[model samples]
Target: MLGSMAIRALSLSPLDSIAVVVHPDDPLDWLPALGNSAFSASPSAWPSIQVVTCTEASQGMSFSIRCGLKALIDDNPKLDAVVVVLADQPFITTGMIAELIGYLSERPELDYVATATDVGGEGEQNAILMPPAILSRSMFEVLLQLEGDAGARKLFGLPQFRGAALLAADRTTVFDVDTPADMVLATKQILGQTYIREHRF
Candidate 1:
């Protein structure tokens, strides 16, 4: 699943590097699996792809975020920003990632660009702000301060952080695979179904 996500991200022309953060429990298993995947099989594959293992993954998502961020920063000290993508979001596409990068690139004032979903209402309902988010170097310190299960979404509420939201290309693009039902829905979406009868509103 993560390998597919990596391939999608790497396919984008705007991205210069990709770091896949794996859990500590099965680092050995994941490393070999990803290396043997189709993306890594090609002789002309990008050399920027790196596999990082989060030693503190058991603590929560923050550990993984820290691991990936540290590796990226160490690899490229001049990195302008990073696109934090979730591997479980199989529906995310290169276009969506390019949109986020484009938004931030065009607006130098904004600290970050995140995806938002409209839940459907008369006024502005609580928007779901999340990844594939682009975070500038200015936000790196704050991001490292995060702990536990808390992620970049928590930073959206901070007044100090100036952020612009991009409407997701579609609901499916942001739909992540967590539960068995979500897996079923993602499978249906992958199969080219536009609507799920059981989930129609």
Candidate 2:
């Protein structure tokens, strides 16, 4: 349900399709909002989401990404492009999703694109976006063979794949639900502070 809500709040357009890759063992607390977002999104142009859950999801993020990418390519061999998103990022509103899709739609020449917020640091800020371009099926196969916790860093470095990082106006776009504290915060945002106290703890 948490992921569904994430989908509903996304800025979806007629031009793009989204592939939501979730871990089979995703926390129960995150379900309601995600499900709500996905089901509540504008039905007319609602993205075709392929829920790819793998047993190896317990392995790492890369496994999940590879599973999702493989599913997307296998199901829709002609998939033009896909927005690789995280189900746990509750703050990413639908408007942000639309903006990213819109930017990519206007410029098809770019292999892939991502949105990031500046996390103030010493010299420069850290940029985070969905990794590894999902341009071709061959690229996805290569991703499936990848190992460890790395998402798609090496794949993006290849000459054939090009990417762009959009500076997010709202930094909340970069907040990802990765730990117990993150779950508590996300639950409050989705189900409200009062609800958390009354139900989720």
Runs in model 2 deviating more than 4 A are 10-45, 121-141, 157-160, 191-201
Residues 4-95, model 2: lDDT tens digits: 55555543544355566666675546534534433445456555654566878778878877777778778778876666666666566666
Judged by whole-model lDDT over C-alpha atoms, candidate 2 comes out at: 0.61
Question: Among these predicted structures, which one has the highest lDDT?
Answer: 1
Q: How many Å off is the CA of 119 in candidate 1?
A: 1.6
**What lDDT does each candidate get?**
0.77, 0.61
Q: What is the TM-score (0 to 1) of candidate 2?
A: 0.70
* Candidate 1 whole-model C-alpha lDDT, 0 to 1: 0.77
lDDT (10s digit) by residue, model 1, range 30-81: 3444444444235255547777888787798888898999999999988889
RMSD of 1: 5.2
- Specify the poorest-scoring 10-residue window by lDDT in model 1: 34-43
